[model samples]
Target: MDISEIAITAAMASGFIAIHLMVRRLNFLDATPRSGWLSFAGGVAVSYVFLHVLPDIALHQREFADGMGVGAKEAESIIYSLTLAGLAVFYGLERAVKMSRGESRKAGEGDKMGNRVLYLHLVTYGTLNALIGYLLLHREDAGAWSLGLYFVALGLHFFTADFGMRQDHPEAYDRLGRWVISAAVLGGWVLGLVVDLSPVLVGCLFAFLAGGIILNVLKEELPEERQSYFMPFVVGVLLYAGLILAERHWV
Candidate 1:
């Protein structure tokens, strides 16, 4: 990595440390906050789409056309075709693997390790998805769709680490997960520089999903038993959309 990469890594590290220091109320946290997790997941998915993929796609629009030099219609079809081709094949392989595994019987009772393995498996697939998006940014002229997928990838990062920390550091929110996530801050920024990608979307996504704390003001919230679970999702989309819109238009 060059000096820029080093600087980015350092910046990310500082950010990670700062963020970890803020999960102060985890002692009162519950891992089964499904609404919060779902909201988190959606926000993360958006993050991946916008951050890594968008800029790459913008760059690509000016680059190579499909192997055949064709008109605008042909270009779009080719782009969508190529995009769906990879995702389709991947989805198919994934289904096949899941089917095979589903058919296999477990020899022993599942334990924490089994659960963690499942999480790791899902996270690993997500990481690969991001990497593939990164590679597409390099090789293909993927446009808006690539942008969308990139945000999805960055979102996956937020989802995994945040969700993992929920489970891993239940009583103690500052464990190795803290260190790991902290490392990812600078690490991600550094990698962005190394890959020659902009860090704007990724960093903001990180700031948003892993960004702040939720203060459920009893006076501000609906009745405890009557609280609508949809609040988190609404908050999530609104936050992201607002951010995107503002950055594009308002700002």
Candidate 2:
């Protein structure tokens, strides 16, 4: 990586760490109707996935086909299956947390998730954060502008994620979870600096991330309890999608 890439990635890392460390301070997101900003952030993240990530998956499919000497159809199926696996894995994790929390409540332990659930949740997201860090240096398009766009979309996604995490395990998340995940982000970036992964591996990771992003965003936005703002979400989708198209055409 050049000096500029280093600088940008460092900033991206810091931004992610800050979201974990500082998300609780953003009190407005706690509103009953749900914050427009969170909805807007969700929309931006989804737009990035559809407009940027899905298209990139086609490129990765080509890489996978070449690397494995497989047919294009077979490679495409493999890439998409990984995406589905990513979504299913996180969905299962979410179910586990909710079940744990429900069991705890039944036992008159209030709304807290059990220690096992808390640990599992933290470890899983920590790994995801690390993957984010690693991909900072190894994304499909490593241009400065691409890095900036990735940071913006994922940074906002982190806000919604942090909020949900805090909701799930208020005490545990505040005390220890955020720190662990924050360090994971930096740890993954460091791993990227030292370890060179194959293009096929990176593509697999990207596909997984795309699935996770879709699940996380929808889980937050689509629930009836959230009362998410539709107008802001629509505006976010239109604006960011336009920006991406413009960038592709001109930049």
Candidate 3:
């Protein structure tokens, strides 16, 4: 990688890791700031999907269809299919994790099945972080300012993730979650440096991540236990959305 690429990767990886550690101290997830920062993060992530990521998906899918001489409708269907698959997979994963957590509370070690469930959740979480890290590098080539904004939104989203994981499995998350998942971001950047994904594959990654972001952010925000603030959510939506909009128009 060139100097610019390396710098972007380092900054984003450090930022992602820093946020996870910061949340443990700041308690942004469970505290009053949850309404402001957490809600804003959730809104920013959602707006990123609707405003920027989804449109890119549509554009890429169209380009893929044209390049392959396929029907536009078929291409659209295929893209949506992958998107739904991504959503369903994460949804199922979260449900299984919740069930395992409940069982763990009930039957001691919750048996081997419960252990496996937590393992799967952490593995998936780490893998997703890596994917996002890789995509961050890809986005940097577009513009530094755009990448900076992306980092802000993603860093905040990861903050909420750290909080949720720590809340769900305090001991396990503290001992393993922070280090492992933080490393995953760096690992993903290295993998991205070596492996050059095709445009279609990159689009698939974006689609999968878009689904994951939507699911994870909403899971944190919509719960009555969260006590999220309306204005912060609105502020986040408008603030991040306006940044993305400005980039779309000017950059």
Give candidates' CA RMSD values in order: 10.0, 0.9, 2.5
Rank ordering of all candidates by TM-score, starting from the highest: 2, 3, 1
lDDT of 3 by residue, 71-188 (tens): 8888777777777777788789878978887787687864223668778888989989999888877751267776777788788888777777777777777777788898898888
TM-scores for all candidates: the values are 0.46, 0.98, 0.91
- Expressed as tens digits, the lDDT of each residue in 1-251 for candidate 1 is 34643453344345434645555444433433444644544554444344433444444442324334565465445444544454554344334434434443353432122334344534433344333323323323233443333344344344434544444233333444444444444444445445754343332222222212111111112335423356665565566655555444443
TM-score: model 1 vs. ground truth: 0.46
Top TM-score prediction, candidate number? 2
Provide the lDDT at 210 for model 3.
79
Kindly give the stretch of ten consecutive residues in candidate 1 with the minimal lDDT sum.
211-220
lDDT of every model, 2 decimals? 0.40, 0.91, 0.78
- By lDDT, the candidates rank as 2, 3, 1
lDDT of 1: 0.40
Using lDDT, give the best candidate's number: 2
In candidate 2 the C-alpha lDDT for residue 134 amounts to 96
Candidate 1 lDDT score at position 85: 50
